[model samples]
Target: MMFGSRGKARFLAAVEGLESAVRDRDAKRCTRGLREIHRAYGKAGDQEIAEGGARLAALLPELPDGPRGGLAVFVGACVERGADARRCAPAVLAGLAQALEAAEEFCERWAASGGGDFPEPDDGDPGPGVVERGGHCAAFGWWTLPQWEMAAAAMLSHVEVRKELDSIVRARLLRDLRTVTEASGHDFKCLEQVLLVLDDEPLVALDRSSGAGYALRMTGLGDTFQLHTLLADVLIGGGHLPGQAPSAREAAVCRDAPGQVPTTGSFNLVAPDGSLLWNEGTPADIPVVDGVRLLVLDPPPYRRGWPAGRFFPNMPGDLVLERVLGAEETAQWFTQVAPAKG
Candidate 1:
């Protein structure tokens, strides 16, 4: 049976509650959200998401106690279903912070022991955009990186960084795959097949230097900082206006002069009907809304100041306003209608 409108609304609410729970790391909310999912799954009709939600609920208990663990479990549960990565960002950021702190501590100890400067990354072409490869990397190496790091910590006696990361890598020797294969109770030959598949995987790569060219290929443990930083950027870079673009001749008249827009956050301009008029950053680009000339303004500053404003400066308000208003093209078409000049 198809879900009625009320059912659809319930399903949507359940999803929203789940996302909020995940983002806020609210265990009570999560439990409520899971109940909502279980109750609404039949009406939702899409078994995959429902099943995914169940799997996530199952995984939640296995996770360590903390907000990070809850977020991580949420991220893992939603992995197969293309859950918004941003929703679990707090968890990812926490893990990255922990890993980076461990790495830095190791680095400092190594330098104290006369290791000198940490080696620079070898010169090579910039790797593919992290987002393009992040999913595969996260999926494959999710369990692997922490395992390897722990093994490294055990081997070194002290928690010191090793000059030869390759040495640490060599000792492990496809341990991740072997563990998974054994757990699967598959034939040994299946391991070979799995290797072949992994070899051709988009995110996986051969690390000739690290593995001594022993046919070792693995996906990179996607860098959390870089991935999220890029996500923060470029996420809001472009978007469309409420409606389709006006015809070409009509668009020409709406073009704002160059050098009038700010560089970043330029798409904040609002149309007369309160919808954003595309990214054409400029007041001049605003069309006559409801037969009245319109102008866009920057959103008001936070009443209580930003939560982290002391630690991190907010981008200038004037710059933000300019960026939203100065761009040349606008969704507002007023070819037949003239904007009043003051």
Candidate 2:
């Protein structure tokens, strides 16, 4: 209620204003407004809002030169501002690792500015990217869209920025990452191997579990974690990222995840309460992700694109995880998963 009554109004209005400015091609006005929004974001105290604001600050540099050259300025400024290439610093990791591959392919469509850089590419036409920007989000930096959104949301929960800008930022990051990486590294992953995903995708909730949470592990990768550190390096032609992220032998591992993809798709995660877990690889014996209040997965079988399982309504379109996991296949794949036994 506090968010709605005080924060939501300004947040909604600012985003609407941004949309209008972008639509009208008012780059100057839009950039300025974004700057103000960033400052105001810090004042509000929401984790997402503050995090997104700093990212927006990174994006602002690209603006003065117009959208065409704005991104370069943004990246240049980010390097100067000290974005952490060695770690997944919330303020610095703009979802680059997840989107580096497609972003490079996508940036090829454009030509750069006075520096002879390739120009900016169109918002669409991403290459081999899994978390393509959607109509709902845009990015202000190079990390994953979901992480940025989560960061922004964290800030907003405290400060309240605007309507969830996850989709808006997702789209923007994909666009910028492409531009930033173009001509930087032909073999994106060869440079680094962190599987960063800028996901605007939704969770296919299988169950609406009671008192569910999630198990989130934000591992700090090693210097060998090239994917996360260098993929973006090749795209933007800046932030060389030291050719390695700080990693211990235990921290050094390949960027392998169930969501390793470069297609124009969204990343779907199940709520830790066992609401949704990809019916792949995960051992049921492993505990559920913490604080998972919901699950996400394919739609029901009766409908098009429905999951390969039996489903019942927990909240109309929503269902409890166990109900959907009734699929023998799902149950089999997940060794550690089971409905919360009362």
Candidate 3:
């Protein structure tokens, strides 16, 4: 809930240290991370209010063998201060559990590939695991929008700050982030990468057990907020996320672009009765209509940004929704995801 130049630096530096510590299997570095994080809170104010700092210290030791769980837990705890904990706690706990499970899955995959035991990085130079240009950490960092939102939510959970969760605040935050990153003189791309690693994109779930089911694409800050809202609805409100929740234009694009894209941009989106559902830069997954591949792109060859161009050139409409939702649910879902240019 507190913000300043120095405090922000301490927070981020501590996060970087914690990430490195987890990767290197170093308990001492973990302790150092806690100290730094605590100092960050202190610099913001005293971590005395809500006993947040102490709670965080206690929770840090319970972090899994990976950085993801601890980072998420820390953000959740920090954000929960003075919040309606009874309302948000369940979702926070469930989200943390999901993060831990995801990290465990990644570790298992790494181990299965005959990857040997983990070892510490070199004394002076952290290995590719640390944020480096064109490194594994860089790639993971790039798409971590989900994690950033978790942190942002925590920062904004307080009553006064929560009021600023709109476009203006987003623009300010993005600008401030850019300024801070520039001041730090780190690689902007790498920083961007690190900030976005917490996302759960291309996947939607009714509950934790659904195991990455369904497809959802989130493009910007508004979508990120929408995602948090949807998750809160599911986890806290006991509601269900619809199987297909595309924008209105997106639905039309889906209907029009089945199996082929006649034009490059929005010029070709025409519905069955000659309604134009034209929109640009809307994204969708591979469209499977009636058990047939309706839209497909030639899977691009492996190279830098290989899959970026592999999307079928057109946006499909509500066929996926028709397959997945009842008429009532479909109507409700459309109302919920009504197209907005945020």
Best by TM-score: 2
- How many pairs of residues collide in model 2? 98
lDDT of 2 by residue, 32-76 (tens): 665555434323434334333344434432332223223323322
The residue ranges of model 2 lying beyond 4 angstroms of the native Cα positions read: 1-12, 45-191, 196-342
Off by over 4 Å in 3: 1-49, 54-73, 81-145, 157-159, 164-169, 172-342
Instruction: Give TM-scores for every candidate, taking all chains together and pairing residue i with residue i.
Output: 0.23, 0.24, 0.24
All predictions: root-mean-square deviation over Cα?
A: 24.5, 19.2, 18.9
Clash count (model 1, backbone only): 10
Ranking by TM-score: 2, 3, 1
**Per-residue accuracy of model 3 over 99-141 as CA lDDT, tens digit each:** 3333333334444545444322221322454323323432233
Q: Which of the two, 1 or 2, has more TM-score?
A: 2
State in Å the error of residue 130, model 3.
7.9
**Residue 319 Cα positional deviation in candidate 2, in Å, after optimal superposition:** 31
Model 2 TM-score on a 0 to 1 scale: 0.24
